[model samples]
Target chain A: MRGITITLASLLILTLISVVFANYAHGYMVFGILILAALKFIGISFCFMELKKAHSFWKVGLLLFLVLFMISVLFLAK
Target chain B: MESKILNHKNIYYPPGGILIWIIIFLELITFGIALIVMVFYGQKELEIFHTSRLQLNTTIGTINTLFLITSGYFMARSVSYLRKGQKEKSSLFLKLTMLGGLFFLGLKTIEYYFKIEAGLTVGHNTFFTFYWMLTLFHVIHVIVGLVILTSVLVGLRKNPSKVAIEDVEASAAFWHMCDLIWLLLFPVIYLLF
Candidate 1:
């Protein structure tokens, strides 16, 4: 219970911090920072939410899905 | 405690899971085609695409991404609490997740209003059309996921069981996938021109 409370509090803090930084970014820096914040949030979700310990199939399936998604996004961006 | 830990030695191949995967695979194909078509269209007409992108509000999209990502965490934690038989904690987290969905939807509606005010309807250009289609599709999904999660909370209150617990976990996983997809889309469509 206490740990959950601390995690939620930190999330709120991190969000505020990200928002402050996000407001100033422009051009390539914008997408770059968004990706960084995204990776950070995913890390927190996986670690604190126990998604890392989910089934191996799920983990591998998620990786495959991400790969395909990235390829499509990059294809369009080009 | 022991029973709560799902067995890793054998993964069941449920028909429902398989069916859902089929649907997801189909959607993936649709998105792939859409991406390819948009790329071709953009290659032939770059100016129109760039102008259409100016209609989007990057700040709102970024904020919504954070909102849904946090919601995914809440949904996952809700399941973890339910697994531990902490009904109140589970309900609280589920409610928080629902609020996250509401928050995203609220911001999206505001964005829609801006697009309308700027005369950026779906018919404006290919980018506008795809933007509205993709995000609104995701918005509908987040709403559906919220409904399922709310029902799970109600079930937990009425007659909780291991099956209810598993249902909540599976539903949360689906919600997380939805959230993650939006996380990827936020940058793809909104941040990048």
Candidate 2:
């Protein structure tokens, strides 16, 4: 519980910082920060969703899903 | 049987079972495609996308993201406590999780009302189209998630032991997916250009 709380707090603080930065960012910086957001999404799934303790199938499956999602979102954003 | 074999060792089994994992993966793919398509369309009208994003309330989106994430934390703890056989503590945490969802829904209603009053309906423009469709769909998911959690709460009172572990884990998994999707949706629909 402590670990999860700390992780959530850290992610929130980092997300706020990233959001503020992304708001004003231009060029590649925008997508870069969005990628940070994607990472946070994956991190939350791993921790909060208990995917860390889940089977290898799920661990691998989620990783692939998010990777493809991030790639598609970023690649198609232009 | 294959089912028994799969569920036996539990080494290769997902928490909520293979069915929910399949559902989660399928849902992720579906939303990923939808969002990617929306962004692809958005690029053609960058001017409208940028301007429309400004009308969105970033603070509210941020708040909801925090709420969902906190709720997710509570949910994970609830499952952990339940597995530990702490029924009362688990029930309390689950209720907290539901409260967070209610807060999110109330704020989202206000945000929608503000948008609708401002004439930002789906047909108003392309960007609003994407905004309304994605977030409304997500809102439905949240509602369903709440229903699932409510069922869990009720079942806990009747007989926590009688409730299948898969059922609770499935609800927990669905709730986590809501948080995950909102985290993805918030920046794209509310913040990004």
Candidate 3:
């Protein structure tokens, strides 16, 4: 419960930052914002979805998916 | 043996189940491809994309993001409550989660109503095309999620003891996946412009 609240609050903050500079933020700045989104994604998966009790392989796979997907989409955006 | 893999206290199977995650990954890939294609089109028609993007309500998108997150939080609370054997509290949270989803749909409908009134439709332009496709598709998922949540709630009420933790967690996993997809979409579709 505490963890979910903290994650949502942090995500809201990151979202505010991203929207404030939506026009000007470029390249790595955009990537950084997306990385934050991915972080929240991982957090929800672990804490909310109860992936913390999941197997090691699932955890590693999710991390790998986040990294690879973010990098690919950013490249495509570029 | 088919219920859920639980032997020596180590999780070999996923929270919801292996099947749901497979469905989730497939859904993500579908949305991902659509988004990538949208990006490529945006590059080609940058002016049209930007102009159409300006027509969208960023505030609404932001609010919807909060709605989804709050609903997800309620879902997590429900799961925890169930784990503690608090069926009634868990049931209340499930209803709250569904309320969150319904509110999101209400706001989304308002946004769409304004867009349609302003001469923006799926066939309006490339940007509107992507807008309708991505968002409407997402709306369908939300509906599916509501169904999933409703079923889980009913199951809990019928027989909380029979309601396995894996079963509840599976429903929760599907709900959170909806949240995750929107989180990915909210930034890229709404704010990235």
Candidate 4:
């Protein structure tokens, strides 16, 4: 429960950060928002979904997916 | 032997088991490809994409994000409680999770209504096309997720002792998939372009 609470708080904070960057920070807004989204994604996966307790294979695979997706988004956005 | 394998902490078995994880991965990949395609087209029609995106209500998008995230949190709690043999608490959290989903659908319906009133249908343009396609598909997933959760809730109510943790975990996994997909979609569709 504590873990999930912390995860939820972290996600909310990351979301707030993204919103702030989207509105106030003009340059690298996309970059910042996507990065924050990635963090939120990891938080939900590891803590909320209990991926942290899962096999190393699944954890690493999920991380790889996120990294590849982020790279693609950034490259395309550029 | 198979039950023992499932009960043991094997590398193949995730929280929700291998099958659901496979489905989750497939779903994520599908959405990822669609998003990449949407982004590619957005670059091609930058002006149209930007104008259409500007028509979107970012505030509503953000609120819906909050709703899904909270819903996911509730679901995690539900599963946790069930594991601890606290059926009542688990049921309560499960209901809260469903409520969160309902709230999301309600707000999304309102947003969709406004978009339709403004003539922002799927045929409006390229941007609207992707918007409707991706979001409507996601909405369908959320509705399916709700049905699954409802069934789980009923099972818990009917026979708590007979409820399988694996089943609850599977349902929770599916619910979180909706949250995960939205996390991917919201920023890209609403904020990125």
Candidate 1 per-residue C-alpha lDDT over B82-173 given as tens digits, one digit per residue, 9 for 90 to 100: 77878889889889988998999999999999888988888887888888888778787888888887787777677665345556656775
Candidate 3, superposed: residue stretches over 4 Å from native: A23-29, B1-12
Task: Name the fnat for model 3.
Answer: 0.54
lDDT of 3 by residue, B126-160 (tens): 98999999999999999999998888888877766
True contacts kept of each: 0.11, 0.54, 0.54, 0.61
Model 3 residue A50 CA deviation in Å: 2.1
- Among these predictions, the greatest TM-score belongs to 4
Q: What does chain B score (TM) in every candidate?
A: 0.86, 0.93, 0.92, 0.96
Instruction: Output the lDDT of residue B39, model 1.
Output: 56
DockQ of 2: 0.59
Candidate 1 per-residue C-alpha lDDT over A7-75 given as tens digits, one digit per residue, 9 for 90 to 100: 556655655555555456654444454555456445543554444654666446645655565555555
**TM-score: model 2 vs. ground truth:** 0.93
Stretches of model 2 off by over 4 angstroms after superposition? B1-12
Which pairs of residues collide in candidate 3?
B16-B170
Q: Where does candidate 1 clash, by residue pair?
A: none
> In angstroms, how far off is A53's CA in candidate 1?
2.7
Model 4 scores a C-alpha lDDT of 0.91
Give the local distance difference test score of model 1.
Answer: 0.64
After superposition, candidate 1 runs with Cα above 4 Å error: A1-51, B1-5, B8-40, B161-163
lDDT of 4 by residue, B116-142 (tens): 999999999999999999999999999
**Model 2 Cα lDDT, one tens digit per residue, B1-193:** 0112235125546776677778777877877788888889888998998899889998998888888888988998998888777889999999999999999999999999999999999998999998999999999999999999999999998877677666788899999988888877887787667
